[model samples]
Target: MKRSIALLALLLWLSTVALVHAQTLPSVKPEQVGLSSERLGRLVSMLRNDSEKGQIPGAILLVARQGKIALFESVGVLDPKSKAPMTKDAIFRIYSMSKPITSVAIMTLVEDGKIALGDPVAKYIPQVAEMQVGVEKPGADGKPTLELVAPRRPMSLQDLLRHTSGLTYGIFGNTLVKKQYLDAKLFVGDPTNAEFVDRLVKLPLASQPGTMWDYSHSTDVLGRIVEIVTNKSLYEFEKERILDPLGMKDTAFDVTDKAKQARIAEPFPNDVTIGTDTTFFDPRVPQRWQSGGGGMVGTVMDYARFCQMLLNGGTLDGKRILGPKTVAYMTADHLDGSVAPGPLYLPGVGFGFGLGFAVRREAGVANVQGSTGEFNWGGAGGTFFWVDPKEDLFVVYAMQSPKQRVYYRPVLKNMIYSAVVKPNGK
Candidate 1:
């Protein structure tokens, strides 16, 4: 009886050590990890349903927990035009999702003492120091024209990160400032970063520096700031500082290889969006305009690696990109209650704007089910990812249907959370 008891105890000790020594991001069954295999099947089924109905062209979904991959799926088509199969390694246009990367790049520079969040925009971009804000006024031709007013304060790097700067995306609305953006073609085609910034400064501010939140060209401006401080193009700096270090080999400002061009994802032929038509970039040919805000093409596995790094507190596979405190600072809410709400996107109710992400202030604010401290951002194209630090979880979805993106982000967020089952029923 004593010998039998000792053998059982030894077996228990071996099991404990196996759990403790788990690898980071190792592919595992959902049940073996902390997720529900049955429920994960349900999540993938929804993707199939959406694709079958022609709601979404195609997508890639990845979920990681406790540093292990629980789910990775490739569904739908690679090219809607050609009906090619969507592979796990197919490239996608991760539009606004690029902002998070640019934001990280800025904070990495801050970590190096090369820059600070509180620095004035004019300090680096001189044209912004004395820029005037625009107020619409009635004109002699029965049309409204912009009347210039001095800004209450100078725009800062922090404001740019939070989208509180008086900038506007021409695609969002028909405001006079947006018209100015349209007039100048601030982000049109192959203009170099310098030319883009020069053309951008010629426009008037959409709002006071810190008064309102407009989803404008602020991130592209932030990208330019990164270029200015590093003395390298935004693409080059990103490759050295973040992408290469993280082993995100397939992520880049442009895909120049002839072979990779065949893997590029394409949107539907007609404009099916409600407000405005999106401009799709052709990766086969390179353009000089590197939109740090929206110009990036990457694979599903590559972006999942990026998300895992952020979930691991700025380190992934032994790489330390940003320190823990810096990640905390970047994801923390910068827009307190004092500032009026900006664009209503994530955490629909109890959420705030962070340096680089939309943070969840409470669990029940949004239509979806998620824990507090849940920060996420999505692309105009149907690509979204969320990191829940409380649960050590992050999920990434990549697709290319701009019109259906609005429907998919919340839908996927809710489905992924519903799939979670407590370990040992704890």
Candidate 2:
């Protein structure tokens, strides 16, 4: 009788503990996630006051947890000139955010044995075989000019993904290769694959393959490489492989539908002096360069679906876009000690360039409250996403700021961490 009573008491304690855990999940309605409703009103008021002072023209913010879209908020006007209010479903030009999706497309091909990480880029695009490295010199005008020289090593598909192939962005920072990339008009206009290939061959690399980390148009080059290997245009390959399977209905390189254009948010600059100039670039035009680096528009909820898919190990609902192992490979660190000679833009961060996104190995610099295994990537405009497996959490923030300063990672992460409970209901 004494032993029976002891066993029953132990079982009761375990049940009580589980019940408490369910109650302490930190889950709440969307409005409750931020400061209270009164505080949120204050936040909106502050945002408006700042906008009038030319701090920012408009903004949209959302926070979701465990598939529950608990908060969706917008402030200021979509267009300062037109005085249009931002909407929850506003579309934005998601620049480098497009890289992660394109990287997914490439990995799909990898899963099918269509390509390998170690494959030479020249194997698919012959013009790349003749590529050279740029050496700085002065022209007759005494201004800087680039001369073509042989590369120390060949650039591989893996090098392109990791930004170690010495291919520098012409606009990233002023350098000899930057001038050359601009002079060659590498990505300025629409061009056939053959034309793009010819221009890329003539351009010189900035460094030897696998030597350094520089954000360049390498993903854009990957777009062309995909066409060569798959024998299909970049859009066609992405559509059949990723978009259709994942049900990302609103995402595309160009906006052809009038209705869709109506919902596309105008890009805003973080600097009030510039604001948003609507008279600038038009997204409706079909261009020759489908930049894998920074070329695509997506809605807020649609992008959330993409994040959720990644959170679930490359599957959404019953559809699987990639193998779980592929997802792991893509998010793992590929950096070597010799690469990235400069201080990292993000402090206490070790680089992990999988197919596209950067994974955070060091937590202190990321200043993120998520798991050490978390990885994320954002756009030029104020768009961001981070996934934490330890917390089973995912967060995305979308804004169309031109200056690229609004979507802060640290503060936003702090807010999310405040709501995350320890596994045992601590």
Candidate 3:
């Protein structure tokens, strides 16, 4: 009788916790969702095996299909040093994954008819009118030096959203202009978004606007723009408009609570430097520069809501953050002729740039398995999420091991697709 009483109490407590997750995906058996429970276990075992082998640190994976969660699990330690068990709510750097959130914020303004995609960015950030394209030519001597030239046309808000603004991340290129980002201190050590943009606006663009797809400070600039237009900080606008509406409780630029800080997933101490995602810059304290391109931290479930919102055509559970048409427009390929097949940042062959995602262009060319209409993005901190509208599926993977980031994204993709017993809502 005592054992039965204890078991009943435990079950009741679990139900209460489930009710607390306002945005939790409904729990459903894999078979009910047309997924093989046994096959899904294969993916879980691999995750455990990888963590046990020290191939990666802590990770959280969530797989939801048809609005029901089929898998959600955490594996490994929160930190190798602490050895505390990982949890589903662990915070992670999220890096470039910030782009999608920032992009969605931009769309919200667009839907309100507050910003026009074609408007010259210089109109708002006037210093941009003074910005010039960095041209390299054999000038005076043969040493390949930078020459300033006027852009064919001023960069517009559209250019910023699709990463065609010609703004280069200093770490990616070796040119003199790339070095300028370093010399200019475009990234803040302790500066406001306005102060950070002061340096960004002064740097010469790497190419003429709309002529190049350089993953860069463009979204960071957009964050500043959000502040200027909404009279709210990017952090504020994102929370009120995106995070809070989506019920992403633990996602933020700063993890204010000391207890939440304890849940931060960290890579091995000896992990190679990952630019701003380096453990050197802590997320516990509030940051002066809120990077829209990267820097936000979140959990697997928090991001799962964001991805599910996109999959559900811009609304979830009565909160309409964006119109279905706007969401569709943003996820469509914007790279048609703007970018060619050279070295690019996409995860696979059949992917192309959208407003804030890598939209899959073909079915068989991707490094992983997915439908052509799927869109996705990843963070330098080994976090990733993808929305497969065709399959009515979305998955989120959060981790902190930069070394295994490259390996696990495809691994999760392959495993998730293989475990699906039904496709295209059949």
TM-scores of the candidates in the order shown: 0.90, 0.82, 0.93
Higher TM-score: candidate 2 or 3? 3
Give residue 199's error in model 2 in angstroms: 1.6
Candidate 1 has which clashing residue pairs, if any? none
| Local distance difference test scores for all models | 0.82, 0.70, 0.85
Model 2 CA deviation exceeding 4 Å by range? 1-54, 137-148, 268-280, 341-351, 367-369, 404-407, 421-426
Candidate 1 vs 3: which has more TM-score: 3
- Using lDDT as the measure, the top candidate is 3
lDDT accuracy of residue 363 in candidate 2? 59
> How many Å off is the CA of 71 in candidate 3?
0.4
In model 1, the worst 10-residue window by lDDT is 17-26
User: Tens digit of lDDT per residue, candidate 3, span 1-426?
Assistant: 999999999999997886576667788888888888898898889989989998887788899999889889898888899899998778888888899999999989998889999989987899999999998888677788898999999999999998888787876547788888766766547778899888888889988898877778899889988999999989999999999989888888877789889988888887747753334357888888888888788888888888888989999878888999999999998986756433456545778878999899989877679998899999877888999998899988888877778888888898889888876567
The 10-residue segment with the lowest total lDDT in model 2 = 271-280
The order by descending lDDT is 3, 1, 2
Ranking 1 against 2 by TM-score, winner: 1
| Candidate 3 minimal-lDDT segment of 10 residues | 272-281
2 or 3, greater by lDDT: 3
Residue pairs that clash (backbone atoms under 3 angstroms), model 2? 30-70, 190-288, 268-401, 268-402, 269-402, 270-403, 347-365
Per-residue lDDT of model 1, residues 215-257, tens digit only: 7789999999998999999989999989988767778878899
Cα deviation of 39 in candidate 2 (Å)? Answer: 8.8
